[model samples]
Target: MLKILATADIHSPRFLDLFIKSLNKVKIRPDLIILAGDLVDKNNIYALKHVYEILINKYEEIPIISVFGNEEYRGFENKYREMYPVFKWLDDEYIILEMKELKIGIIGTRGALDKPTPWQSRHMPWLYNYYRELPLKISAMIDEARSKGAKYIFLVSHYGVTYKNLEGEPRNIWPYLASSRMEKIIKDKKIDLVIHGHTHNGVRDKINIDGVEVYNVSLPARREVVLIDFTPKSKVFGLEKWLYSGG
Candidate 1:
């Protein structure tokens, strides 16, 4: 089975310890390691260098995929991209990784705040157009993946997908935070699973969007890695485990 391990919203220094700890404890090497976004706290070259060093030493062998978080796009995005070459950034496009028996297509975007929310209008008007474009861009990526012989598709983002996972957070904060557009996009793509982390207070639960499994995997509180086992339709087997969550 192909095992996929993922994490997101790890704002720089915080991720250093987590990365080391995770590496020491992981018994099996994952086929791929996915960083949803927010890899660095600051968009400076120094922070990117540190992140690059850590990843190169620890996860070089495994294929690493990522996208830029809102933080990365603030000012120094061009510099960040110019410096880092190890990571495969998804941005508005899709990436297809062919594993042993699984053709996994990954589509991702970062910091997709909800639209039609008052807080957004008042606070983050800069992101208004970006938020508007995300849903359509992701939909196009999904179609591209399906056309590329991918059997399973995964959506990765650095924003909460649904309010079901954001139950504990303040009601008013919900609309301005995660992407409410996620459900429709996933349903349309018939995506196999969705993985994301933005709402630190969000719960780790699965939302079945027309039979698709959406996992809100904000790792700060739970501090765990998700291991997803995949096999082709002809193989007939599946398994997933949460490591470091004591499950």
Candidate 2:
């Protein structure tokens, strides 16, 4: 079985000490950790690095996967990435982790988020360029992962993929929160699970796209790191309730 711990919109390192302790309390040592985005507060590049270092020190053997949030790109995306060489920065790309008996493929990107309908306003063109062209690029990455013989696929992004997970946010900004294009990709990608952050005000929303499960793991949404399990032969993948809510 493969165990994964996922969180998002963790804007600071204040909760990490407790977070690490909680993991120990649960007796779950995750093989993989996924951080969706907003890892730092504002433009404080140092904060992201400092928190990441703590994670590296604590889980030295674990593989950490991450993507950049809109805030991370405020100025530190490039610089912050260069500072952390121990982690996997999988923005707009794919990686295959070959487990003993199964292979897990992950395709990640910040994701495009243009409005789906004409009623919604167009916005965030500054970040929208990626929100514009990333879908097609991400599709290729997904295809590439399948070609590499991945048994399961995880689609990680810093933006929401569907409107279902973006509920509770202002209706006016729906277009800026996630892209319809990404949802279109979900239909074809056959993703086993979709994980993303950015919707802090939203619930721990779970939506089904075709057959794939999409989860919004924003810090506020989950209130803790969520542990997910996957059986190699049975191919069962889902949240396993091995965590606590952050205070």
Candidate 3:
């Protein structure tokens, strides 16, 4: 089974340091590392690159997949890309990761907010096209990934794809947190595992839309690096005891 370490909304390099230290203490090395976005507090290329270097240094040879969050897009995305040209930046991307025994397809995007929630503030007219079109584009990406014959499909984004993962966030900010259109696509696509951050709510909530599991892996939310095993017929018996919140 390939072990994956997933984290999101790191916001600072300090969290990465602590996370690495904690991993060392436990003697756990992951086969893959996925960052769900918000690598820095501010959208500075230097700041984001600094954090990226720290991550690469700690987890050498492990494939890392990352996306830009709302914070990263606050400035010019091109500037950020120019700094780290070699990294797997998966904002609007479909890629395949081939392991010795596992083939996984990753579909990623920095999801846009659709003003479906009642409390959302109005966005500018120029940005209207994005709010309307991003969901469809992202959904198409997921379909393309699945068509490529991946044993496991991981759909990742910066915005919450379902309201189930945004429990702790205020209702007023719900519109800013995720899109109902994305949620519908996720359920329709029947992806294996959907991951996202942005909302700092914990892993205490999950959106099981038609048995598709969606998790929020934000650092402030999960408070710990998430560990997942993709070996067939495997289970972490003792650990899954009480993580579920509802009956």
lDDT of 3 by residue, 136-183 (tens): 887787677767877667888988886666778887778778887888
The number of the candidate with the highest lDDT is 2
Model 1, CA-based lDDT: 0.70
Residue pairs with colliding backbones in model 2 are 112-131, 113-178, 113-179
Worst 10 residues of 3 by lDDT: 235-244
TM-score, model 2 to reference: 0.84
Q: lDDT of each prediction vs. the true structure?
A: 0.70, 0.74, 0.70
For every model shown, the clashing-pair count is 0, 3, 0
C-alpha positional error of residue 190 in candidate 3 after TM-score superposition, expressed in Å: 0.9
- Flag the better candidate by lDDT, 2 or 3: 2
lDDT string, candidate 1, 1-247, tens digits: 6777777666767666775576566666678877777776765446667667766677668888877775575556556667887777777678887889577788877747776367447876767888877788888878888888877788888777767678767888897668778777777767777777766676554556666666665556346656665544552334354654431
Which pairs of residues collide in candidate 3? none
TM for every model, in the order presented, reads: 0.85, 0.84, 0.82
Q: What alpha-carbon RMSD in Å does predicted model 3 have with respect to the real structure? A: 4.9
Candidate 1 at residue 189, lDDT?
69
